[model samples]
Target: MLKTRVIPCLLLRGESLIKTIKFDKYGYIGDPINTVRIFNELEVDELVFLDITATRENRPPNLDILREIADECFMPLAYGGGVKSVEDVRNILSIGLEKVVINSHAITNPNFITEIADTFGSQSIIASIDIKKNFWGKYEVLGVSGTKKTKLNYVEWAQELERLGAGELLITSMDREGTWKGYDVDLVRKITDSVSLPVIANGGAGNLQHIEEVVKQGNASAVALGSMVVYQGQDLGVLVNFPDRQKLSNIFG
Candidate 1:
């Protein structure tokens, strides 16, 4: 059986780390390097860093800060945001990230995905699909940090990503992100069932049970949590925590 990976999705704004809800209301979490050290100690399965403003600002990911995090990270790291060309993908991988994620460009310039995938092999590329429910009660694909909507269907997009040689699909539910309720299992299943590529479900992971739901029911290959892994207590103070060794073994063993 494939072991389900429990990943922490860290949001980046410039060099600082932040979290968001429903793709809005950004909240400062802490320093990226500091958080990475904590997760490294906890032995996290992997880490995903996304530059929330990269696309909007038309800037590439901060390689200087990312290099610092890469030096500290012991687990596999995947990065996303502002990757517009093959050179951008090459530079990110050269820094030691296991994968480079492409979002808005995947929709606006889909051929870019194929270009990168072909050059670096599919496993080095991840397709990030952000979804939000419109007023009409249907899930619509969003881009540019969830500010713009695309007419493409989420599942259809996932299929295209696989066809375009994306080794994995990272799906985030804008409505449930940072809500601490749970993942949108229906939304996860919508893509997992349509494609053979591994699907990493992000958003709405409140607890271990929520993680299990996505894997067992939604058939997701992995689960990525942001707020649940970063905050604690009644005040919801910034805290870097993860399931202990035995607890993690129980979940995936």
Candidate 2:
């Protein structure tokens, strides 16, 4: 079996890094560059930097900030937020980002996925799907930073993204986001089973056991954590934070 990845998901609001609950009530954490320096020392497997407010604010990614974070990062970095065009993808990759994740843009024009993949290869493209369970208990796509709802079914979207040449899928459950209640296993399973491409499960990661559950049950290729790693007063992110290489190997290995 391929080793699973434990990735740190950082939410960037303007120039600073922050954490949020249910995609709202964001609390400023620290500087993005400083966070990158610390994660480098932690020797994490990979990093995901998202400009959480970009799409909601109707703006493009801050390339200048991205460049600074890229320079500080030692591990592979994936960036998303307000990435709307092939040029945006090209510019980000040019500055050394390994992958570009598209949420609102992809939902609006999936062809951009094909265009980006054709130019940069599938491995450079990631489709980030934000989902929320409605009254029907079915997961539907949420857009504009989880404020608006799209009629797209989560499973159908994931399959389409892969068919359009997205190399990976970053799935986040809005209902479970930052709750630390654990991932939405059923939601993860739906996307993972529907796509041949790698799927990274995000939201609701509370502990190592939750990490194991997401991979084993959700069938995710990777598990992404935010508050669990950023909350300074918590045990997971504070006292027992920054998993050692051996511990990571034991979990992913």
Candidate 3:
């Protein structure tokens, strides 16, 4: 097994899989089931399937589709996007997902985090904090898939979530997402410095060096890939792939 977790964070828009740029524009990738098969063959550490539109649409998770993916997926899977109540988390876990990531609902009802963490366990929960910088260059927390910006200081929020029983944090950078530039190391460092939860730095991973930088410089425990895994390269065609594990082990070790 790999010492450092390298997860593929796939975006779901309706029944299809897609990749987004800065959480705004998107390109069709392919069907989620097919994509999961590809990742399975690669023996990836884990996979994150986030329904980018589920929460914004005011609906519960699409259990039908999730069940399909769960049936086909061989590796540990995590899900985010329309998870709201403890019941939803229960249902999702029953489908074999290792963790349920919460965002908008956690802001609306922090108690929900406590309730689920108590009912399930902290290890089963991953509090997702979507962050973006404003025009004035201040980091801001986001809800509803990076559309609704909040005034909550991200570092404080991350610490609170860890205190509230979140075992890990999915720190997403809206500005660098899908740009293939790199992760927001500064943003990740602040949260890591403030909280002990394992930080999975998401968004804007162009190469393995970016992964090395985030884990070393940013103190991130894991790295999440978006554009780097789904496409052949920046602006290239869709090809579900993962970096060679030998190269990754060499870098992280």
Give me the candidate number with maximum TM-score: 3
Error of 3 at 195 (Å): 0.8
- lDDT at position 203, candidate 3: 87
Among all windows of 10 consecutive residues in model 2, the one with the lowest summed lDDT is 232-241
Question: What's the TM-score of each model vs. the native?
Answer: 0.96, 0.94, 0.99
- Residue 242 of model 1, lDDT score: 78
All models, RMSD in angstroms: 1.6, 2.1, 0.7
114-163: candidate 2 lDDT, tens digit per residue: 99999999999878999998899877899888988999988888899999
Note the clash tally of each candidate.
0, 0, 0
Q: What is the clash count of model 1?
A: 0
Candidate 1 lDDT over residue span 121-153, tens digit each: 999988999999989989999999998888999
lDDT of each: 0.88, 0.86, 0.93
- Screening candidate 3 with a backbone cut-off below 3 angstroms (N, C-alpha, C), the clashing residue pairs are none
Candidate 3 Cα RMSD after full superposition onto the native fold (Å): 0.7
lDDT, model 3 = 0.93
The local lDDT score (0 to 100) that residue 164 gets in candidate 2 is 92
Q: Candidate 3: worst 10 consecutive residues by lDDT?
A: 147-156
